[model samples]
Target: MQEAEDLFPAPAPAPAPAPAPTPARDHSAAGHRARLRERLLTGGPDALADYELLEFLLFAGSSRADTKPAAKALIARFGSFAAVLEANPLAVQEVKGVGEAGAAALKSVSLAARRMAKGKVKGQPVLASWQALLDYLAIDMANLNRERVRVLYLNTQNRLILDEIVHDGTIDEGAIYPREVIHKALDIGASALLLVHNHPSGSPEPSRADIAITKKIMEAGRNLGITVHDHVIIGADGHVSLRAKGLI
Candidate 1:
């Protein structure tokens, strides 16, 4: 009671202003990711646009930077979201800032999409779902670094009985042997067959070797009473069908 100033002792020096609350750093990137995740979960499939879906995919790898530009750039470069996902890992690396993380993200997404498509076609007559089969083949074979010749062996019902890799190397006529193709089909007890190969150059247009191999396979299939359904050449850009072009 001797003095009011002495009693309070200057309010204890104002408690050092509470240390300014540590300035509350921003976490916009993390916040954005959380929001995107919520959209995917609550809104279902229609919740995301093409780019938004791509953005969500990139978030797995590029969580720190803005993903909008990367997503847009990918679609712009590849001409579509599907094409970007189907692109080769090296091809995807061509994009700026698309390092190991980005390429891995795209590759994983493409592989997951392929698995989903394969599940849809499983235990079903593949011939009836020709478009689905082509889409699956296109996504799987496009953008490979090396050529891979795969054969889908079918039974009498045109169902996929076996899928085998007959040859993997450069896609040329001499690289594949008609006898080997015939023997593999026979070994698998396949009554019908569809041939597929990839072009690393991204041009599905058939080369002389492509045509020759198709002819040899078709001839062998004929002699063995097996149907040669189609020869599909997949490239980075698009796919070519021998049956559609009347080459088979």
Candidate 2:
């Protein structure tokens, strides 16, 4: 009772500390995109730099973070921005933080590019747009990890009529059958054909088996009265045309 004031003294709780603000990392990705969009709007075609163009392509995949490091890393690893876009999905994913989403974005861009290239020559003679055809083929084939042999069945007008994936396996000479190829061509009503395949080792150089297979396909097409336009071998490095190389 004598020390009532002391006994009833109120205790004070400590005040809560203020939260520290999160430091802003350079919004490099957003800034980069903004600059590119501005340039594209202000200037006409060819306004953006190659790296900036690549950066725009990459922005779709890395919406949350800076893509400059990733794009730079890709160009650095693959030697060029074109090479980066040409890299296979697995190879593209090997870069840090380039997960499935990034892979899909890159592949979608490739597919779209191919569609546009094909559209340029659609309903027209294929020979007239050979560059477009080569571009479509190179972009589509350069990234494959496995060996795949495909046939482009064409009509008499040399317009694309059908694209068939005939065999997917190791590139041994025996895997491709001229008889089977001819039969498929007949079934598809193709008057002409283009042979295409990929090399997993990143070398477009034709193996003995590759050359033999090309010869067999050429012979079969000839006997069936179907023209063989080209035999193209694709690899990560690039593509080689057997007909162009005098191998067919």
TM-scores vs. true structure, each candidate: 0.68, 0.70
Candidate 2, residue 200: lDDT: 71
Residue ranges of candidate 2 with Cα displaced over 4 Å: 1-30, 40-51, 61-64, 76-101, 170-174, 236-238
lDDT of each: 0.80, 0.78
lDDT of 1 by residue, 149-239 (tens): 8888898888998877777786442256778877877888889888888887889999877888889888887988988888888887888
The weakest ten consecutive residues by lDDT in model 2 span 167-176
Q: Cα RMSD (Å) between model 1 and the true structure?
A: 9.3
Which regions of candidate 1 deviate over 4 angstroms?
Answer: 1-27, 38-54, 61-105, 170-174
Work out candidate 2's RMSD over C-alphas.
13.9
* C-alpha lDDT of candidate 1 relative to the true structure: 0.80
Candidate RMSDs in order: 9.3, 13.9
